[model samples]
Target: MRSLPVYVASVEAEGDRDETLRELVTTDDPDLAEKPIVENFTTEALGTGLRSLRYTQTEEDRTIVAGVRYAWRSQEAGCDVVVIAAAPDPRRILGAMDDIDAFVEQITLTVSSG
Candidate 1:
Protein backbone atom coordinates (compact mmCIF):
# COMPACT_ATOMS: atom_id res chain seq x y z
CA MET A 1 0.00 0.00 0.00
CA ARG A 2 2.69 2.50 0.95
CA SER A 3 4.82 1.34 -1.96
CA LEU A 4 2.12 2.37 -4.41
CA PRO A 5 2.43 6.06 -3.50
CA VAL A 6 6.19 5.84 -3.31
CA TYR A 7 6.48 4.17 -6.69
CA VAL A 8 4.35 6.79 -8.40
CA ALA A 9 6.20 9.68 -6.79
CA SER A 10 9.62 8.24 -7.53
CA VAL A 11 8.84 7.55 -11.17
CA GLU A 12 7.34 11.01 -11.59
CA ALA A 13 10.34 12.72 -10.04
CA GLU A 14 13.17 10.73 -11.58
CA GLY A 15 11.80 10.79 -15.13
CA ASP A 16 13.66 7.62 -16.06
CA ARG A 17 11.98 4.37 -15.13
CA ASP A 18 15.11 2.29 -15.58
CA GLU A 19 17.04 4.52 -13.24
CA THR A 20 14.17 4.65 -10.79
CA LEU A 21 14.00 0.87 -11.02
CA ARG A 22 17.67 0.73 -10.23
CA GLU A 23 16.83 2.80 -7.18
CA LEU A 24 14.07 0.36 -6.32
CA VAL A 25 16.62 -2.43 -6.65
CA THR A 26 18.76 -0.81 -3.98
CA THR A 27 15.91 -0.01 -1.59
CA ASP A 28 15.62 -1.44 1.92
CA ASP A 29 11.97 -2.36 1.52
CA PRO A 30 11.55 -6.14 1.50
CA ASP A 31 8.83 -5.98 -1.09
CA LEU A 32 10.79 -3.88 -3.61
CA ALA A 33 13.82 -6.04 -3.08
CA GLU A 34 11.87 -9.11 -4.19
CA LYS A 35 10.30 -7.74 -7.36
CA PRO A 36 11.10 -9.73 -10.46
CA ILE A 37 12.94 -8.03 -13.26
CA VAL A 38 10.68 -9.55 -15.87
CA GLU A 39 8.96 -8.14 -18.93
CA ASN A 40 5.61 -9.74 -18.14
CA PHE A 41 3.51 -10.26 -15.02
CA THR A 42 0.82 -12.53 -13.54
CA THR A 43 -1.21 -11.69 -10.44
CA GLU A 44 -3.65 -13.58 -8.22
CA ALA A 45 -5.42 -12.33 -5.15
CA LEU A 46 -7.14 -14.61 -2.66
CA GLY A 47 -9.65 -13.57 0.02
CA THR A 48 -9.02 -9.82 -0.49
CA GLY A 49 -5.79 -9.64 1.49
CA LEU A 50 -3.73 -12.33 -0.14
CA ARG A 51 -2.14 -11.43 -3.43
CA SER A 52 0.44 -13.69 -5.02
CA LEU A 53 2.68 -13.06 -7.97
CA ARG A 54 5.05 -15.09 -10.12
CA TYR A 55 7.16 -13.80 -12.96
CA THR A 56 10.45 -14.53 -14.63
CA GLN A 57 13.40 -12.23 -14.51
CA THR A 58 16.53 -13.35 -16.37
CA GLU A 59 18.36 -14.32 -13.20
CA GLU A 60 15.80 -15.24 -10.52
CA ASP A 61 12.36 -16.80 -10.76
CA ARG A 62 10.99 -14.84 -7.79
CA THR A 63 9.61 -11.40 -8.67
CA ILE A 64 7.79 -8.25 -7.49
CA VAL A 65 4.63 -8.73 -9.45
CA ALA A 66 2.69 -8.48 -6.25
CA GLY A 67 3.67 -4.90 -5.61
CA VAL A 68 2.87 -3.94 -9.17
CA ARG A 69 -0.54 -5.50 -8.87
CA TYR A 70 -1.07 -3.74 -5.57
CA ALA A 71 -0.14 -0.41 -7.07
CA TRP A 72 -2.72 -0.85 -9.83
CA ARG A 73 -5.30 -1.80 -7.27
CA SER A 74 -4.48 1.21 -5.10
CA GLN A 75 -5.60 3.58 -7.81
CA GLU A 76 -9.13 2.25 -7.58
CA ALA A 77 -9.23 3.06 -3.90
CA GLY A 78 -9.42 6.76 -4.96
CA CYS A 79 -7.41 7.38 -8.06
CA ASP A 80 -7.06 6.74 -11.77
CA VAL A 81 -4.92 3.76 -12.71
CA VAL A 82 -1.91 3.91 -15.00
CA VAL A 83 0.30 0.95 -15.66
CA ILE A 84 3.71 0.99 -17.27
CA ALA A 85 5.92 -1.96 -18.10
CA ALA A 86 9.43 -1.93 -19.49
CA ALA A 87 10.06 1.70 -18.74
CA PRO A 88 13.75 2.20 -19.40
CA ASP A 89 13.53 5.63 -17.78
CA PRO A 90 10.92 7.47 -15.74
CA ARG A 91 10.54 10.04 -18.51
CA ARG A 92 9.70 7.13 -20.73
CA ILE A 93 6.57 6.64 -18.62
CA LEU A 94 4.18 8.87 -20.48
CA GLY A 95 0.54 9.66 -19.66
CA ALA A 96 1.21 10.34 -16.03
CA MET A 97 -1.91 11.75 -14.38
CA ASP A 98 -2.59 14.67 -12.10
CA ASP A 99 -3.92 12.01 -9.77
CA ILE A 100 -7.29 13.28 -8.64
CA ASP A 101 -6.72 16.84 -9.69
CA ALA A 102 -10.18 17.82 -8.59
CA PHE A 103 -9.54 16.50 -5.13
CA VAL A 104 -6.29 18.40 -4.95
CA GLU A 105 -7.71 21.63 -6.31
CA GLN A 106 -10.62 21.50 -3.94
CA ILE A 107 -8.26 22.08 -1.07
CA THR A 108 -7.69 25.59 -2.37
CA LEU A 109 -11.31 26.44 -2.91
CA THR A 110 -12.32 29.14 -0.46
CA VAL A 111 -15.68 30.08 1.03
CA SER A 112 -17.17 33.43 2.08
CA SER A 113 -16.39 34.29 5.68
CA GLY A 114 -19.90 35.65 6.15
Candidate 2:
Protein backbone atom coordinates (compact mmCIF):
# COMPACT_ATOMS: atom_id res chain seq x y z
CA MET A 1 0.00 0.00 0.00
CA ARG A 2 1.11 3.57 -0.68
CA SER A 3 0.12 6.84 0.91
CA LEU A 4 0.48 10.47 -0.01
CA PRO A 5 0.43 13.18 2.65
CA VAL A 6 -1.54 16.25 1.77
CA TYR A 7 -2.40 19.49 3.56
CA VAL A 8 -4.91 22.16 2.58
CA ALA A 9 -5.48 25.45 4.31
CA SER A 10 -6.82 28.96 3.88
CA VAL A 11 -5.51 32.13 5.49
CA GLU A 12 -6.37 35.80 5.39
CA ALA A 13 -4.30 37.71 2.87
CA GLU A 14 -2.03 40.47 4.09
CA GLY A 15 -0.17 43.21 2.23
CA ASP A 16 -0.06 42.96 -1.57
CA ARG A 17 -1.77 40.02 -3.24
CA ASP A 18 1.05 39.34 -5.66
CA GLU A 19 3.59 39.54 -2.87
CA THR A 20 1.59 37.16 -0.78
CA LEU A 21 1.35 34.68 -3.64
CA ARG A 22 5.07 34.98 -4.25
CA GLU A 23 5.81 34.29 -0.64
CA LEU A 24 3.59 31.24 -0.63
CA VAL A 25 5.53 29.72 -3.52
CA THR A 26 8.92 30.53 -2.05
CA THR A 27 10.69 28.82 0.82
CA ASP A 28 14.09 29.37 2.37
CA ASP A 29 14.28 26.43 4.72
CA PRO A 30 17.78 25.20 5.51
CA ASP A 31 16.72 21.56 5.15
CA LEU A 32 15.81 22.07 1.53
CA ALA A 33 18.05 20.24 -0.96
CA GLU A 34 18.17 23.32 -3.20
CA LYS A 35 16.13 26.22 -4.43
CA PRO A 36 12.53 25.29 -5.09
CA ILE A 37 11.23 25.14 -8.66
CA VAL A 38 8.24 27.47 -9.01
CA GLU A 39 5.83 28.01 -11.86
CA ASN A 40 2.72 29.97 -12.64
CA PHE A 41 -0.58 28.12 -12.33
CA THR A 42 -4.17 28.93 -13.21
CA THR A 43 -7.05 27.06 -11.68
CA GLU A 44 -10.66 26.97 -12.75
CA ALA A 45 -11.94 27.97 -9.34
CA LEU A 46 -9.09 29.99 -7.89
CA GLY A 47 -7.86 31.67 -11.06
CA THR A 48 -4.15 32.49 -11.44
CA GLY A 49 -1.77 31.05 -8.86
CA LEU A 50 1.64 29.50 -8.29
CA ARG A 51 3.05 26.03 -7.82
CA SER A 52 6.34 24.96 -6.32
CA LEU A 53 8.35 21.77 -5.97
CA ARG A 54 10.55 21.29 -2.95
CA TYR A 55 12.79 18.52 -1.61
CA THR A 56 13.81 18.52 2.02
CA GLN A 57 16.35 16.24 3.68
CA THR A 58 15.62 15.07 7.16
CA GLU A 59 18.54 15.36 9.52
CA GLU A 60 17.64 12.49 11.86
CA ASP A 61 16.80 9.91 9.20
CA ARG A 62 18.59 11.50 6.26
CA THR A 63 15.58 10.85 4.09
CA ILE A 64 14.42 13.09 1.29
CA VAL A 65 10.84 14.34 1.43
CA ALA A 66 9.39 15.56 -1.81
CA GLY A 67 6.68 18.20 -1.70
CA VAL A 68 4.50 20.11 -4.11
CA ARG A 69 2.81 23.35 -3.03
CA TYR A 70 -0.04 25.13 -4.77
CA ALA A 71 -1.13 28.61 -3.76
CA TRP A 72 -3.90 30.88 -4.91
CA ARG A 73 -5.21 34.21 -3.70
CA SER A 74 -8.97 34.41 -3.76
CA GLN A 75 -9.94 38.00 -4.47
CA GLU A 76 -13.58 37.31 -3.79
CA ALA A 77 -12.86 35.69 -0.46
CA GLY A 78 -9.91 37.93 0.44
CA CYS A 79 -7.81 34.97 1.48
CA ASP A 80 -5.13 32.62 0.26
CA VAL A 81 -5.69 28.94 -0.33
CA VAL A 82 -2.79 26.56 -0.25
CA VAL A 83 -2.52 22.86 -0.99
CA ILE A 84 0.53 20.78 -0.30
CA ALA A 85 1.18 17.20 -1.38
CA ALA A 86 4.13 15.35 0.03
CA ALA A 87 5.72 11.93 -0.02
CA PRO A 88 8.84 10.24 1.22
CA ASP A 89 9.69 9.04 -2.27
CA PRO A 90 10.26 11.70 -4.91
CA ARG A 91 8.95 9.38 -7.62
CA ARG A 92 5.69 8.95 -5.75
CA ILE A 93 5.09 12.65 -5.62
CA LEU A 94 6.03 13.08 -9.25
CA GLY A 95 3.83 10.22 -10.35
CA ALA A 96 0.84 11.64 -8.49
CA MET A 97 1.13 15.16 -9.80
CA ASP A 98 -1.64 14.76 -12.34
CA ASP A 99 -4.11 13.45 -9.81
CA ILE A 100 -3.16 16.14 -7.33
CA ASP A 101 -3.59 18.84 -9.94
CA ALA A 102 -6.98 17.49 -10.85
CA PHE A 103 -8.01 17.57 -7.22
CA VAL A 104 -6.91 21.16 -6.94
CA GLU A 105 -8.95 22.06 -9.98
CA GLN A 106 -12.06 20.83 -8.26
CA ILE A 107 -11.67 23.20 -5.34
CA THR A 108 -14.27 25.97 -5.17
CA LEU A 109 -14.42 29.22 -3.23
CA THR A 110 -17.52 31.29 -2.72
CA VAL A 111 -18.10 34.73 -1.23
CA SER A 112 -21.36 36.55 -0.62
CA SER A 113 -21.73 40.21 -1.36
CA GLY A 114 -23.74 42.36 0.96
Candidate 3:
Protein backbone atom coordinates (compact mmCIF):
# COMPACT_ATOMS: atom_id res chain seq x y z
CA MET A 1 0.00 0.00 0.00
CA ARG A 2 2.63 2.53 1.02
CA SER A 3 5.00 1.53 -1.72
CA LEU A 4 2.50 1.96 -4.54
CA PRO A 5 3.53 5.54 -5.34
CA VAL A 6 -0.10 6.52 -5.61
CA TYR A 7 -1.79 9.78 -4.66
CA VAL A 8 -5.42 10.40 -3.78
CA ALA A 9 -7.55 13.37 -2.79
CA SER A 10 -11.05 14.76 -2.94
CA VAL A 11 -12.66 18.09 -3.80
CA GLU A 12 -16.12 19.52 -3.35
CA ALA A 13 -17.41 22.19 -5.69
CA GLU A 14 -20.62 23.80 -6.78
CA GLY A 15 -21.56 23.79 -10.47
CA ASP A 16 -23.08 21.74 -13.24
CA ARG A 17 -21.51 18.40 -12.30
CA ASP A 18 -21.78 16.90 -15.74
CA GLU A 19 -20.41 19.99 -17.45
CA THR A 20 -17.48 20.24 -15.06
CA LEU A 21 -16.69 16.59 -15.60
CA ARG A 22 -16.82 17.08 -19.37
CA GLU A 23 -14.37 19.95 -19.06
CA LEU A 24 -11.94 17.82 -17.07
CA VAL A 25 -12.25 14.96 -19.53
CA THR A 26 -11.80 17.24 -22.54
CA THR A 27 -9.11 19.54 -21.20
CA ASP A 28 -7.18 21.22 -24.01
CA ASP A 29 -4.04 22.03 -22.04
CA PRO A 30 -0.99 21.30 -24.15
CA ASP A 31 0.83 19.15 -21.60
CA LEU A 32 -2.16 16.90 -20.89
CA ALA A 33 -3.30 16.90 -24.49
CA GLU A 34 -0.52 14.51 -25.35
CA LYS A 35 -1.25 11.93 -22.67
CA PRO A 36 -3.26 8.98 -23.88
CA ILE A 37 -6.68 8.42 -22.37
CA VAL A 38 -7.12 4.95 -20.95
CA GLU A 39 -10.71 5.07 -19.79
CA ASN A 40 -13.73 7.32 -19.19
CA PHE A 41 -17.21 6.59 -17.90
CA THR A 42 -20.25 8.05 -16.11
CA THR A 43 -23.03 6.53 -14.09
CA GLU A 44 -25.84 7.29 -11.65
CA ALA A 45 -26.54 3.77 -10.54
CA LEU A 46 -23.34 2.84 -8.71
CA GLY A 47 -24.03 4.30 -5.26
CA THR A 48 -26.44 6.61 -3.48
CA GLY A 49 -26.81 9.87 -5.39
CA LEU A 50 -23.57 9.19 -7.17
CA ARG A 51 -23.11 10.43 -10.73
CA SER A 52 -19.49 9.80 -11.59
CA LEU A 53 -16.65 9.56 -14.11
CA ARG A 54 -13.22 7.92 -14.15
CA TYR A 55 -10.22 8.82 -16.35
CA THR A 56 -6.74 7.39 -16.51
CA GLN A 57 -3.56 8.04 -18.44
CA THR A 58 -0.01 6.82 -18.72
CA GLU A 59 3.04 8.71 -19.86
CA GLU A 60 4.78 7.68 -23.06
CA ASP A 61 7.76 6.50 -21.04
CA ARG A 62 5.35 4.55 -18.85
CA THR A 63 7.00 5.96 -15.76
CA ILE A 64 3.98 7.86 -14.54
CA VAL A 65 0.33 7.06 -14.05
CA ALA A 66 -2.57 9.37 -13.24
CA GLY A 67 -6.30 9.04 -12.75
CA VAL A 68 -9.32 11.17 -11.98
CA ARG A 69 -12.74 10.30 -10.66
CA TYR A 70 -15.68 12.73 -10.65
CA ALA A 71 -18.86 12.10 -8.72
CA TRP A 72 -21.91 14.25 -8.40
CA ARG A 73 -23.35 14.01 -4.88
CA SER A 74 -26.85 14.36 -6.22
CA GLN A 75 -29.18 15.76 -8.89
CA GLU A 76 -30.72 18.10 -6.33
CA ALA A 77 -28.07 20.85 -5.99
CA GLY A 78 -25.55 20.43 -8.72
CA CYS A 79 -23.03 19.45 -6.07
CA ASP A 80 -19.96 17.63 -7.30
CA VAL A 81 -17.18 15.64 -5.71
CA VAL A 82 -13.98 14.66 -7.47
CA VAL A 83 -11.29 12.22 -6.50
CA ILE A 84 -7.89 12.13 -8.20
CA ALA A 85 -4.83 9.93 -7.97
CA ALA A 86 -1.43 9.38 -9.54
CA ALA A 87 1.46 6.99 -9.21
CA PRO A 88 4.42 5.46 -10.91
CA ASP A 89 3.82 2.97 -13.75
CA PRO A 90 1.40 0.08 -13.77
CA ARG A 91 -0.89 0.47 -10.78
CA ARG A 92 -0.21 -2.28 -8.32
CA ILE A 93 -3.31 -1.58 -6.29
CA LEU A 94 -5.63 -3.89 -8.13
CA GLY A 95 -2.96 -5.78 -10.10
CA ALA A 96 -4.89 -5.71 -13.39
CA MET A 97 -6.72 -3.18 -15.53
CA ASP A 98 -9.84 -5.34 -15.49
CA ASP A 99 -10.09 -4.94 -11.72
CA ILE A 100 -10.74 -1.23 -11.96
CA ASP A 101 -14.44 -1.54 -11.32
CA ALA A 102 -13.79 -3.40 -8.13
CA PHE A 103 -11.29 -0.78 -7.09
CA VAL A 104 -13.74 2.03 -7.80
CA GLU A 105 -16.47 0.37 -5.85
CA GLN A 106 -14.26 0.49 -2.78
CA ILE A 107 -14.37 4.28 -2.78
CA THR A 108 -16.77 5.81 -0.31
CA LEU A 109 -18.06 9.40 -0.14
CA THR A 110 -19.94 11.48 2.36
CA VAL A 111 -21.92 14.49 1.14
CA SER A 112 -23.33 17.07 3.49
CA SER A 113 -25.78 19.74 2.32
CA GLY A 114 -25.39 23.17 3.84
The prediction achieving the highest TM-score against the true structure is 2
Query: Which candidate leads in lDDT?
Result: 2
lDDT (Cα, tens digit) per residue for candidate 1, span 30-106: 43435443332223321111112222233364432322221212212322222323222233222222332222222
User: Candidate 1, after superposition: displacement of residue 99 in Å?
Assistant: 22
Ranking according to lDDT, highest score first: 2, 3, 1
Residue 23's lDDT within candidate 3 is: 53
Give the per-residue lDDT digits (tens) of candidate 2, residues 32-112: 898998888898789989999999988899899899999999877989999998888999999999989998998998787
Off by over 4 Å in 2: none
Report lDDT (CA) for all predictions: 0.27, 0.87, 0.43
Residue pairs with clashing backbones, model 2: none
Q: What TM-score, to 2 decimals, does candidate 2 have?
A: 0.90
How well is each residue in 1-114 modelled by candidate 3, as lDDT tens digits? 454332333445556754665554444334452543434444434343222222344456534344443343444433444444444444553353334444555655554667
Q: How many clashes in candidate 1?
A: 11
Provide the TM-score for each candidate, comma-separated.
Answer: 0.19, 0.90, 0.47
RMSD of each: 15.4, 1.6, 5.5
